[model samples]
Target chain A: MTGPRETLVGITDVVKHFAGGGNVLKREKRKVHAVNGVTLAIRQGESFCLVGESGCGKSTLARTVIGLNAPTAGTITYRGQRIDDLTPKAMAPYRRRMQMVFQNPYASLNPRMTVQTILEEPIRFHFPRLSRAEVKAKVEEVMLSVGNDPHWGSRYPHEFSGGQRQRISIARALMVDPEFVVADEPISALDVSIQAQVLNVMMDARDQRDLTYLFITHDLSVVEHFGSRVGVMYLGTVCELAETKALFANPRHPYTQILLAAIPRLDASGFRHTRLAGEVPTAMDLPSGCVFHPRCPHANARCKAEIPALKDQPDGTAIACHGIEEGRI
Target chain B: MALLDVSNLNVEFPTRHGTLHALRDVSFTLDKGERLGIVGESGAGKSLAAFAIINLLSKPGRISGGTITFEGQDLTAMDTDALRSIRGNRISMIFQDPMMTLNPVLTIGTQMVETLQAHRRISHAEAKRIAIAKLREVTIPSPEERFDSYPHELSGGMRQRVVIAIALLTDPSIIIADEPTTALDVTIQAEIMALMLDLCETHDVGLILITHDLGVVSEVTQRVNVMYAGRVIETGSTRDIIDAPKHPYTRGLIAALPQQNEAAQRLNQIPGSMPSLDGIPPGCAFNPRCPHVGERCRREIPALRALGEQQVACHSAEEVAALAGNGGSAS
Candidate 1:
């Protein structure tokens, strides 16, 4: 195992933008700024979470980091080396070190392929030099590591339950022995009972493999429970970053506070649904100054004109809200 | 009067191997203007219970036994032809997938108008006008513009709001919303819950909300029913279910959820898989996974015993609650 001090992934000022069009021939470009200027780091064995609403660029950032979609600007360096500029030939090695587990296990795996074939395909591609017997042994070990019975490999993805397919997906990710894994909403598409089982299995595997995770999800409860530190994003910007305790206990940002209040909580009497205003704003046409200013209950005139950059606080956390910065609330 | 009374309702789907009992001896009473939250894990038959009330279960799935009385009308015995008139005009429903309740090619206006026309003999123009007003009643953003948009054109939240608007078109006496906001984000979910709660109060409609979310049920429902493996394992006021859950399954679910408190070392996830439909254990369905299982629990399926306003079906309910630190005597 590598030293715990190793920097598994370093993402610096990563930006991703997609251009759609009204006029195909006239070349009208309507750019949707998905992940604009995101930067964070993941140590060798820490769990990091990127949390936001459905359209707030969490998934885009995950894809950008895993090299699925190339970023529009900035650098993605794994273990202190840049690979965005490299050709496909040079990028092949990086692919083996980083694998992604998608949200929908039903669609993520090949519908026709057996779980055994899915696991073996990665092992075959990443370790072409290994003999057939060695590849089969490695695949079985990977399956066992993910808490799936080795015999389950013969079953198709449909034959297994949602939780089991997720295990298969995780097994496929581990078959390559990736140092950094991007788990994108892995538990969202599961039953609550099944969700618990899958989460436990993932945690156990993370421990044994010493894997670095870029855990992307919309569920703040899971994020607080599992993430070592978290970055709360809104409108393609990191609004807040802090240790799990500091963030949940004394959230510095107004958006972060709103999100926390919005989640349903159970007390003796019943569920307390925090009454926040309106729906999430369309990212294409966000507010002029602060992305969260329109929704922030503590917004002022100053928030409407000047954008707040992430500023340090006495507590070891970073927040980018004018209200937090000026102590307005 | 209790606006809705369900007694010994059992739903079954005829599979090749055997008849799968999706619901078993389910019983509950919902008074007028009351919100009854049904909470359970997936496949716990929470949604199936809701569907059964509407007589909307698919082919091969039929009501095996019992009755549902709405304002003294035998809902279980009413044929589909007789049911259709009262179904939308009096009792409406919303689904977890908002799209399932909506037609894709039809504009929001066309759909609402058709629903209005089916029950009330109104002119086409009058129907359109009422549809617009109903749309506004549900607080859809720019209802006029949204009335023209198809289901596909609107966002998930908007579609759900429109679905609620359709449900409220006739001022239904009862509304069964099956996980309405389970698809939406937190902010939007809160908005939807508040909207539904307000509408239910204004109309004095009995609302039977089917959901697995403890938080969702607790926020709006006056009463809560905890289901497990196709049985209503526990029933009480929301306070009792949340603060003084008696059944081990209820306690297990509460413990499993991640609380907001930052001091948690780990979530207490309930172990063992939910027994498959065909593999339900004979005694307590939750016996294998329940932390407080005893000898009697594995031998006999306990009947729901009366305890104040709450009802629980567990042989060791008292002992389990005490051990689980409920800090109160089981009634």
Candidate 2:
């Protein structure tokens, strides 16, 4: 536990673009730039949170990292080995080491499958040599770890409440004992009380199993509580990356500042929020230089013409804004 | 007289098995130009209370008992023609989804003009002028150009701005917004809430905000009513409720927030989930999850009783408030 932590997943300049908006007669096609030129590293046993608006492509990047959607470019390395381009058979081992949890538990878990069957299917597919009794023992252990009753394994997903179903979803992800887990908005669909329960379950699983996470969510409050490090995404680009405390205390990028200022805290009132001028531009028709330049208040002529690259600050935070580099912000 | 008063409001849906009580004995009053927030979980009947105020409950769901008094008139007893004038003119509604509220085919300007002309005897040109001015009031950029654009042409935030403009078009005395910004991003939601607050204050319009987000409720509303199961368990000033809640359920709700906890610490999660409407527990609906539950809680339902500056429907409100002196929890 005291060893030097190493980078578990190294993502370099990843890009994902989808072909969208074609016509039957006019034959017009446009590229929806979902995740573009995002570079980040997930260290061992750290919960790296990616936060942004709905269309900011944070989910797209998470899906791309897990190989659910193939990246249009760039490389994803797992423990100094390139695994993004591996074939199905070759990628099977890496898949066992990495698992994903989706946003909606209602849709993620199969209604027809019992808890035992759902937990056992992954083990059977990954390691066919394991006996039924061994698989059952593993399922019971994981179920109990997540606070679900092992005796209720015969019940279906619908029998459990939403919070219990989400716990089951976490248990399913841990079935493979993956070293890394990518949970995309795991608690967004839950109530406030239930959200805490699910988040606690995830935190406990991380501590007990020594797991690393790439948690994606739009909620800044949850990120403040759960994230070790945070990356703020705007139009598929990482605008700011820092420790959660640093990000919340002193957000450097203009977009990050606006995003943080908009969160309605319980301690403050009177409807005060920093006003951003315009709405987020569509990804299909992104701005020329910086994707956020159209809405950024600190944007200048250079910002409109040249894209800003992520520059490291002396305090270890990375910001992608010309204004920050020029001391204008 | 109060601008709007709801007393002993009960809404129910008659199902084949039995009648499902969606809301029970909910009572609150909204003064002129005042903002009241109705906060609870999803199935706590916050939206149903709002829907019942305007006689807009969907099929089979009706107001079983209560009085919705608007300007000294009982809205529940009013005829369709009398209520029609009050629905969008005296009091208007802003739904959660802007796309659902705005007609997809109709342009923004047309919807605004139609809404204005429905109640007032105004010409098309005068109505168009008022529509554009209302749009400008909401700070929609280039109101003239946006008026001509269809609902699909604008972004989500812009569409909500247009919805707010329409709600304000008739110069209504009160606006009932039910989770109006829940579909938008946080940044957009903040802007919208601020804009609504500004308009409500400047125009002297009462607001009844229904949402599940406690932070937004605390920031935008002066008073809040905490609903659980079907009843309003706690009602008090927003500051009082946020600073020191009386009800155990309300305390648990405030403590459950991620912001209330230390960084990376486990949140103060309530033990059980909210019961379904069909299978509501007897006595206090929150007795199963209440930390201060007693034998009396399971035997009889608690009614709203005055407790210094607030009204709470919990038998152990005094003990709970004393135990958790501040911050609602051990955190």
Candidate 3:
């Protein structure tokens, strides 16, 4: 599973920080470290999932990879090409190869636009010379592939159900024939039953289109089923990265172990959870050393003083924890 | 007698076009200190069923026909003043979004004290003392400091804990939580749920947990009601229902879970979405999406019949049970 593969996207020590309240007169300044020194490579044809709680900067990382948000430091390479610093006009070609699917279908799709118009806008923008009939054919093809009725393409987005609206969103993403997609919590807004339908559509699209996915979500169950490789993030840093099966079966980091243990499994009878001491700290005011040390039961004096770099273990998992490296936990 | 007993409950929203039956024939019972979970998709009337029990339905929505009996007293027939005494004092409710449920303008202590004083004739200082204890009971760090904070000062998970504390302030016998943890993160949800379970057990409180997560239902509740299209399609022990679900809809829901299947496999999705309240199909409301639909299922409504320890509202319950035994596949 860890065999050599073509790296589609390489993120090297990427950092995205947003400046907080500070006036010209006031010398005091604050910065929200949304993504802090994260490094990872997304292999081609793999479903790479970034799992974290809210405000952990998983969304910010996804946006940074797609060039939606510029990194404050480090570099982002796309297929052996440095594309992060490219201007909008220079990055236009990469844009066609990469796309994004947002979480909320209710807000992602324009209520005023018909599904036909929504799907065709991307095709028309990418291929302006195509005939109207050709563009319509592409729209219908994508819609049918997503298990939506092409005839319903004329209907407004508000007319469709949540599941159908998500299908439309997927169809729009596929309109440009993108090879890679960054789906930010795509199915979180849908119901459990509807989540399966949308996930099936996404898997089908991946297989049919040979598309690599940067899947970001907080749901561990979905990640176990959908992700090929998983990255566990905490406070804007990649705490652990490993194959999905390895990560689920033998989580390395303390936070990863706690996160996996906290999931309510159907096979389990009673409620049992890993008891962490404190809540997730605010991103604006990060802790001194290991960001997760405050709540980590395995944290020691060393863990509280110095941040551990993500080190590769014998099992091929990169874990950022001194306790794991020292065999303390 | 059970702490809470709802029978033949029907909730409707009368519109200009027609009366939308949001909940029909929804019935369940909660024993003392027992937790009952209502699992369903959105628009399935799980929340409406819980709302109707407390007579907290918004305008245009009314309990057209039903009996919600609590401790041998009919809640639906009670007068406003009488119901008011029972609403917060005897049966407290928790909504999904704690931020919306809590009063943003008021401090935590003020709100909890208000709730305590509204139900019991206690002095302000006594109410404040009780409120502080409840806050501490929910495990909010530094209860004294947090009591002065408003809703915006707390995080999503802490706000939910505050909401739970408020619900438990009156020492209510029954707590109807409608997706209480849905708005929080998964880890936070686990902690909050564990806290609720521990508190409920310690205090011998009956809980009516309404959620869409089957995993949470299987872990928390002793008994479960699986709802579909405004109807209680299946009701049984959580163990029995999760292990060998009798209804096609229930089986579909369990199979639809991503954990039930292998990685990258097509999930066993129930074909179509649930019907809107007004457009629910005749006969069996789930006949359209049900895998085991028959001619009788299409022509007549099935009554909830007892099969072993489970109550199933399916014309093909026996066949479905047999099918489940032979490896139930939702595809």
Measured with C-alpha atoms, the lDDT of residue A56 in candidate 1 is 94
Judging by DockQ against the true structure, name the best candidate: 2
Output the chain A TM-score of model 1.
0.94
Between which residue pairs do clashes occur in model 2? none
Pairs of residues clashing in candidate 1: A271-B218, A271-B219
lDDT by residue for model 3 over B1-331, one digit each (tens)?
8888899999888999989988888888999999999999998888888889889999899988989999999999998999999998889999999989998999999999999989999999999999989999999999999999999989898999999999999999999999999988888988999999999999999999999999999889999999988899999999899988999988988999998997778998988899887788889999999878999988899999998789999999998888777765444
Which parts of model 3 are misplaced by more than 4 Å?
A1-3, A21-28, B328-331
Give the candidates in order of lDDT, highest first: 2, 3, 1
DockQ of each: 0.45, 0.84, 0.81
Better of 1 and 2 by lDDT: 2
Q: Looking at model 3 chain A, report the run of 10 residues with the lowest lDDT sum.
A: A20-29
Ranking 1 against 2 by TM-score, winner: 2
Tens digit per residue, CA lDDT, model 3, A1-329: 34667999999999999988456588768889999999999999999999999999999999999999999998898998998999999999899999999999999998888888899888888899999999998988898999998899779988888999998999999999998999999999999889999999999999999899999999999999999999999999999999999999888788998899888988885667877888889988899899999998888899889999999888888999998888888
> Proportion of native contacts in model 2?
0.81
